[model samples]
Target: MTTPADTTAPPPRRALTAFAWFWVGAPLCWGLYELGVKAAQLFTG
Candidate 1:
C-alpha cells in the first residue's frame, strides 16, 4: 500500500507563527486596555 502525504506544517514553522502572533497581539491588547482606561477616566473625571 502507498503512504499518504504529510500535508500539515512543520513544528518549527508552527512555533514561529505562534511566537509572532504573541508579539503582535500583546501590544494591541495593551493599547486597547490603555485607551479604554483613558476613556473611562475622561468620562468620570
Candidate 2:
C-alpha cells in the first residue's frame, strides 16, 4: 500500500514578512497623512 501524503503547511519567514509589511505600510501611512491634511484644510478653511 502507498503511504499517505503530508498535510501540514510550512511556516512563514519572519524577515520576508517584515519586509513585505514595510513596503506595504509606508504608502498606506502616507495616504492617510495626505487625507488628514486635506480634511483639516476642508474643515478649517
Compose the digit string of candidate 1's lDDT tens values, residues 1-45: 233458554345667778999999999999999999999988898
Which residue pairs clash within candidate 1? Answer: none
Residue 30 miss distance in model 1 (angstroms): 0.9
In every candidate, how many clashes are there?
0, 0
In model 2, which regions exceed 4 Å deviation?
1-12
Q: How far off is residue 14 in model 1, in Å?
A: 1.5
Q: Once superposed on the true structure, which residue ranges of model 1 sit more than 4 Å away at CA?
A: 1-12
Best by TM-score: 2
Q: What is the lDDT of every predicted structure here? A: 0.80, 0.82
| Candidate 2: tens digits of C-alpha lDDT, residues 1-45 | 233457454554678879999999999999999999999997898
Error of 1 at 9 (Å): 6.7
